[model samples]
Structures are given as C-alpha cells and as structure tokens.
Target: MSSQKASRKAKKKQGGKQRAQRATSNVFSMFDQSQIQEFKEAFTMIDANRDGFVDLDDLKDTYASLGTDPEETILQAFKVLDPDNKGVLHKDYLADMMQTQADRFSRDEVLQMFNISPIDAAGNLDYKSLCYIVTHGQEEEQA
Candidate 1:
C-alpha cells in the first residue's frame, strides 16, 4: 500500500513535468521575433519570484506591488485556468485570458462611461436621454 502511494506521487510529478515540457511552442508562429521578446518581458513581469510559471502567489505578489488585492472574478478565472493546481500556472492560458478578461473589462468600462454620460446629466435616466446619448454622441464625435 505504501509503495502504491509513492508510485502515485511519482507519477503525478512526472505528469507535471510532461505538461510543462509540452507547453513550449514556436513563438514565431504566434508573434514575430520582436514580439516574442515583448511577451517574455511581460511574462517576467507577471512571473514574480523570477520563476518561469506565473502561479497564484505571483498574482498576489503583483497585487502587492500595486497595493491591492486581485478582484474576485480575476481570482476565480485564474483558479479555473490553472487546473493542475500545482501552484504553477501555464502560460498558454494567458492568451485565452487576454481574450476573455479583456472583453469583460472593456464592457465594464463602456457601462461605466455610459452611466456617467451627460446624456442624463441631470442624473435621471430617461428614454429621451438614452436615445440622445446613443445617437447624438456619435454625431458629435464624428463632427
């Protein structure tokens, strides 16, 4: 029984190493040589402790640098993306994160901007004001 447990532990560690190795890709296929360096730079920024993988601790470290905690959604997203829970978050999910997280962030910004719009500067969200902001704002911007 003890040997079986040790075997399982060894297999898990080996699987982790295999996953790490399988993660490598031809950077040129996704980005040009110059862009590859930019990614490495960004990865280094996120990879606190100078480790190759950005784990949950790195996120906390990054937040410490910014003097804030990671938002609930961001924490959840990170947990979901890092399925192995090996405390090492593989970088491939970073690309997917950019797409998913970025969209939600931008949508939030739009909602905030709309909320503050002078379309209802009087602080009342009437139908007329909504229409004016929806149509008039674009016309004014184009002018």
Candidate 2:
C-alpha cells in the first residue's frame, strides 16, 4: 500500500511538471519576431514625445486613446508598474506588468491591465509567460 501511495505521489508530481512545461511552451509559441516588433511600435506610439520612456502623461494619452479614463487610481497603478522609478515606463516594463496582471497570475497585481492566470504555479513570471502576453492581441490580425 505504501509503495502504491508513493507511486501516486510521484505521478502527481510528474503531471504537475508537465502542466508547467505546457504552459511555458504555450507562452513561448506566442512570442515571435513580429510580436517583438509590434510591441516596439506600440511602445513608440505610447511614448508620443519620443522620449524613450513612457511617463504618466504618455500613459494617460494611451488610456484616452483606448477610450478609457485615466483616473487617479489608474495613474497610481501605472506608477506601481514602473519599477525603474524614472517616472517613465519602458516597453519591457509594460510587458511585464501586463503579463503579471493576467488571470491566474501569482505575481502581485499592479495596474488593472492584466487578468490573473494560474498557468505558472510560481509567483513570478517566466520569460515565456511574459512573451505570450506581450504578443497576444497583436498576433491574430498581423498573421
């Protein structure tokens, strides 16, 4: 009976690992060169001043363009997402923030830009997860 129990536990562990691998694979499949280009373009558009960074004003403009109101709460969320404390957001930072906020997300929620996901059991995001989200919406029409 003990041996059977051990086998079951091992199988469960293997299954968990497999799930993680699948999630990672799915995430990586989403990130292609074109996706990177799209992100760059989007970032450029957000940074209207061409200042190489997205400040609060730029974020507000982006929100407005999306037909969303940039309320104080939203602004605070942006600030929380901006890790560099440069008062501006980089493309990578935005991507990370978006992915981290997605559904089943284990990471801390910042802006309401993402839906939390449990795809990755780890609290932090792996590269593939980040790549997947950054490329998500843009892929369908571009391809």
Candidate 3:
C-alpha cells in the first residue's frame, strides 16, 4: 500500500510539471537562447526595484532618478502593455511580445508553412523537417 501510494504521488508530480511546462512553452519559445537572454537583461533594467514585476512605481522610480517626471506621451507608450489590464507588467509577456513582433517569421507563420509537424515530440523544432523546408521551399508530406 505504501509503495502504491508513493508511485501515485510521483505520477501526480510529473503530471503537474508537464502541465506547467506546457503552459509556458509558448510564452517565449519563438526566440533563440541569445534573444531570450537579451530580453531577460532588458526586463531586469526596466524592473528598477529588483522586484519580479514592473508596475507604475518602478517607472516612477526610474523617472525620478533621471530628475524628471515622465511625460504623458511617454506614459502613453506603455498603454499597450499589460494586455489583461493587470496593471503590472510581467517579464514573460514582455518577452513574448518582443519575440512575436520582432521576428520576421512568427511561430504561427512557421507552423502554418509546413503540413508536416514542425515541432518534434520533444517540443523542439524537428530539424529534419526544417532542413527539408529550407532546401525545397515547401513541405513534402511524409509517409
């Protein structure tokens, strides 16, 4: 009974981990490692107080250090952020937007370009399919 209970608990933990990974896989998977690192650095810069999230207080502190209040125009620039109207800007959202908007080939575009699965079972790009796409400039259905 004890061993069975332990096995069930382990399975639950693994399932929870998989769910967490799936939840975040689309957050910034469009970016390469270097781009993700750069975004992390930029987020750190904007966070101001070393807190995990960015809010009005962080921006005010940044402007205060510059010896001036932020202009209305400057504030307007951030209005597009916080898409959920959450008031706080999350680092993940910042990275996702940057990757999606700045990339010439967005994730959705790439996924649509191939009839074959672009992503392998491991959730990374299927390099074999990618090479085929690059060489042929079109998808060839696999058997």
Candidate 4:
C-alpha cells in the first residue's frame, strides 16, 4: 500500500479524542428523572434490613457480591460519608456519597474545594477546613 493510504488508515484508527467534562455541582442533575428513581431503588435494595438505612454490613454484602473487598478504602469512605456517625447510611447521604465519594477529583474541582475551605493564598488549610473536608461531602457547600 502507498504511504498516503497508510496515513489515511492511521488517521482513521486514531479516532477523535473526547474533551474533559466539567465537574457538575449537582451530581443527580446529569441523570434523567427515571434514572434517578432507579438509583433510589438500587439504594433500597442495598439497605438489606429495610431499616431505611444501610449499615457497614450491608455495604460489605454488596461489595462482596460485586467481587470487591469490603476493606479499608471503603471503611474510610463510610466514615467520611456518615458524617453524623449514626452507623446507618440513609438515602440522602447515599446520594451525597454517590455524588462525592466515587469521583477522582479534577484539577478544577480540587481548586473549587480548596477555595471553599479555610485554605489561604499561601496554600495552607487550617484545621477547620481540614475537618470540614473530612466530615462533609467535598462538593457540599460550607457546613
């Protein structure tokens, strides 16, 4: 084949690159209402005891069923997600966790989060900000 044909083939194989998406403030806003309702239904399934909340055991069960570990990472996440330390994960917090926990922070998101907290221009985050970031969802407004 001629070099020109090979070049065309290479170009076709390269395909188009996707642009990076902006972080949405309201995570559920991206989904259609039916999809959102389905998410709630899935949460209900995870609640196991029908106690209107999911505890660590429920989380472990779901994780195990999905062939993943119910290990430290998830434990720490639950600690962070269950800010009130109620030992039960409710639907609202579940939604907030889905909104906040799972995402790898984009640079813009990091900046936004940092800006909201007690970080100064010199790149120091005070204890309050650190505490806030730990207890509340990353994208949640000042608590």
Candidate 5:
C-alpha cells in the first residue's frame, strides 16, 4: 500500500478503537431516582453539622458506617479529591472522586449517566451535585 493509504488506514483503525471503547463503557450505564435519594441520605449522615459540607471527621465517621477502617486509605482518598483541602468535601469534589472510582467511564460520561445538571449554567458541577451523583447508584446496575 502507498504511504498515504497506510496513514489513512492507521487513523481509521485508531478511530474505530476509540468508538468501540466508548460504546463498551456506555453499555451498562444508567442512573435511577432511588440512587439519588440514597446518596442524599449518605451525605446527610456524613455531614453531622448539617453545614452542607463534610469534613475529615465526617468522612471518618461515614467510612466507619461502611465498615471500612482504613484511616490512611480514607485520608489519601480525601487528599486526592480535596483540591481546596478545607477538610470539608463539596459536591463537585465528591463527584470527581466518584468518577475516579467508577473507572470505566470518563468524568463527563459519569456526570451524564447520573443526569447531573450543570452548575450556574456554565456546564460545570458544584460540590453537592457531584456528591449526589457519586453517592447515588445501585451496585448491581454498576456491575
């Protein structure tokens, strides 16, 4: 084959792979209302002060409820997502964490799957909204 033809073929192959990956990732994705409710409940439980934010202490408490006693893991997880490190988790931070955890989907894809509305009409997400998207979701459906 000519060089031009070979280059075109390679590009087409790469594009095909990208499309296939997206399709595969989206095949089992969905979000339900109950999942949203569950996330809200979990967030409420973690936000002991009802300040609409969850601090490290609140996170520790939440993990304890989940039977996970990884102080280091929890701390690391928090550090990874807590850009401001205010020790309090905002909704958008939580959503980013959730997207990281999902692994199969990109952050944007995960947001879309959860039906999260944009923040301030700028097409971004806030802490609370991100929290809801990350926390809400059925395990079986995720599988």
Candidate 6:
C-alpha cells in the first residue's frame, strides 16, 4: 500500500510539472526570440543574486547599484512640474505647459471645451462631436 501511494504521488508531481511547463511555454510563445532574450536579460538584472527569483533584497541591491532612490527621484520631479508647490496639477497649468513646438491645442483644453457639449448615454462623445473636434470647429476662431 505504501508503494502504491508513492507511485501515485510521483505521478501527481510529474503531472503538475508538465502543466507548469505547458503554461510557461504558452506564455513565452507570444514573444519572438529577440523579445524573449531581452526579457531574460531584464529579468537577470532584476534578479540580482542570480537565484532565478526577485525579492525585496534583490530589488534593493539593484536600485542601490544604480545609485537612485525612486521615491526621492519622483518627488523631485513632481516639485519641478508643480512650480506653485500645490502638490497637485491644475487644468490651466497643464494646458499652459509647452509639450510640443507646434501651435496645436492642448489635450486638457480640448477636453474642457468638449465638456460644454452633451455627452452620450455612455458618457462618451458621439461620432459627430468627435468629427467636429477633429476638424477644428469654431473653437479655433475663439482661440
């Protein structure tokens, strides 16, 4: 009876391993060879101790090697973006930002202008409104 139980456990373990392999293969098959290699290299960088797994220690070591504290970096960047130091970006401030060299309308401005019109039942702009906006409607003259 013990021998039979051991055989059954072995079969179950083998079946689980096979299922895991199949799942891994299906996921990897979505990417080409170059993409797979790139992902492997990225994973290797994140798995700093080379133990084939990423933990908090590995992440700390990786970030330490790069000499960057992500939280401080993000906070500094936000400070630069938020000149008034309001801790949040207002719509007008976003609209005035020089995102591109061209004179095209800012996305925030477009959305604000679109708010004047009635939205559809789904809270989406209809095809006609989309066309009017894309075609540079009377908003251009007003600007």
lDDT of each: 0.58, 0.59, 0.60, 0.60, 0.63, 0.63
Model 3 C-alpha lDDT per residue in residues 1-143, reported as the tens digit of each score: 99999999999999999999888788677899999999999788879989799987777677677786555433344346634443334433443554577544565655454344355454443333444444345654599
- The digit string of per-residue lDDT tens for model 2 on 1-143 reads 99999999999999999999887785536789899889889889999778999986787688778887645444556566655544445434555656666554333443333343212343332333333334332233365
Candidate 6 segments whose C-alpha is farther than 4 A from its true place: 1-25, 70-143
Which is the winner by lDDT between candidate 2 and candidate 3?
A: 3
Q: By TM-score, highest first, what's the ranking?
A: 2, 6, 1, 3, 4, 5
Q: Model 3 scores what on Cα lDDT?
A: 0.60
CA RMSD per model (angstroms): 18.9, 18.0, 21.4, 14.4, 16.2, 19.1
Better of 1 and 4 by lDDT: 4
Candidate 3: clashing residue pairs, number:
0
- Give, for candidate 5, the lowest lDDT window spanning 10 residues: 130-139
TM-score of each: 0.31, 0.34, 0.31, 0.29, 0.28, 0.33
Off by over 4 Å in 4: 1-31, 72-143
List candidate 3 segments past 4 Å from native: 1-25, 64-68, 72-143
Tens-digit lDDT track of model 4 for 1-143? 69999998777666432112333256888899999999999998798778888986777678777887645444566566557664445433344445566675555655554555554455444434344454444674587
For model 6, residues 16-83, the per-residue Cα lDDT tens digits are: 99999887787777899999999999999999889999986787677678997644554565467666
Say what the RMSD of model 6 is.
19.1
**lDDT value, residue 89 of candidate 1:** 38
